[model samples]
Target: MTYETILLAKENGVATITLNRPPMNPLNSQLFKELGHAVDEIAEDNSIKVLIITGSGSKAFAAGADVSEMAYLSPVEVYNFNMGSRKTFDKIENLGKPVIAAIAGITFGGGCELALACDFRFAAENVKIAFPETGLGIIPGGGGTVRLPRLIGVGRAKELIYGGEMIDAVTAEKLGIVTKVVAVDVLMEEAQNYAAKLAVRPSVAMKMAKESIQAGVNLDSSSALNYENQCFITAFASEDAKEGLGAFLEKRKPNYTGK
Candidate 1:
């Protein structure tokens, strides 16, 4: 499908989605809606093993939601917008597969939240990340309040959100916001290399592991273990599990069909 605000492509078992509104791609309503559509497509397609999301240009991942779009929104409209973005982020978070955010430039406000939604993140040394919503007399409405704390802990999340301060990729990695920070020239190479490795693993185990971890986040100790056990047992019934055991006994590599 043709997209006005984004670019979508599939290659090397990876689906790459780029936010194309250059010069600090501000998230206008149209861009947000188009993002929803693009994300939905990636989620529904079975051929996509891993999803990589990033922004065009080297200046910004996304500046923030377009301020022009914000000025006229009623309180209810704002509420609806939050719900939409939350739903979209949730889809990526619980996509039943892998999604990685390749943060190349600036990641602020909605952009930071979007990256947080991904299962993993890779940032370049040139990248900057923050939740500066409070600077605008607002708050991070797109799961930043919920997910950021989960990713990087409450104290640090509060500092960034409340202070409206930006952190470079090095600090972000220290805080666990980004898994790795590399040079800009190797950003895509590193991200794709990771994706390629993930694609060859047991797909069923990966899916179940993702669900177990995400669902366990909100559950108690016993419940979390129970959920984890269920995922493990389910995998035992999969063909991939048989292949894995057989290959182990044969002292050979296992080939998974994603079954």
Candidate 2:
């Protein structure tokens, strides 16, 4: 499918969606629309096992939401826009396959929320992450207020959101917001390598594990444990699981066809 605000590319079981709106790649209504379409395509394409999200230019993964598009919007328009953003983020979070955010330069406001929706994030050493909406007299209308705290804890999330300060890559890593920090030039390469690694795992097991984790997060310990055990049993029934066991017994590498 054609995309105006993003670029989609697939190679070797990995798909990448690059935020293409130049220097800052600010999020807008059109960008959100294109993202929804792109994500839906990715979900339907079995050839794509992993998705890496990043920005085109060196300046930003995404600076923030396009304030110009939102500044004068009616209250109802604003509500609809926020819901669209939320839906896009939820799609990424629940994509079944792993979604990795390859963050560079500035990732603020909605951009930070976008990364949080991913299973994990990798950032360049120069990347700056922030949740600066409170300073603008508005709270994070997207999933930032929800996902950020669940990721980095309430205190840290509050510190970032309330202070509205841009934290560097090292600081973000320290806060557990990003998975790892890499040299700028190797950021994309590293992220792709990680995706390639994930793509080779048993697909059914991976999906089940992801589902269990996402669901388990909101459940009580007893219920979560029970659900995890059910997921384990379900994965054990897959052909890949049998192959894995057989290969282990035979002392050979398993050939997983994502069954």
* Candidate of highest TM-score: 2
Model 2, span 4-53: residue lDDT tens: 99999999999999999998999998999899889999988888889999
Q: For model 1, how does the per-residue alpha-carbon lDDT over 100-154 read when each residue is reduced to its tens digit?
A: 8988888899898889999889999999888888887889888899998988889
| Colliding pairs, model 1 | none
TM-scores, one per candidate: 0.96, 0.98
Residue-level lDDT for 243 in candidate 2:
94
Error of 1 at 104 (Å): 1.6
What clash count goes with each model?
0, 0
Model 2: residue 16 alpha-carbon error in angstroms: 0.2
Report, for every candidate in turn, its global Cα lDDT versus the true structure: 0.87, 0.92
Which window of 10 residues has the lowest lDDT sum in candidate 1? 27-36
Candidate 1 local distance difference test against the native: 0.87
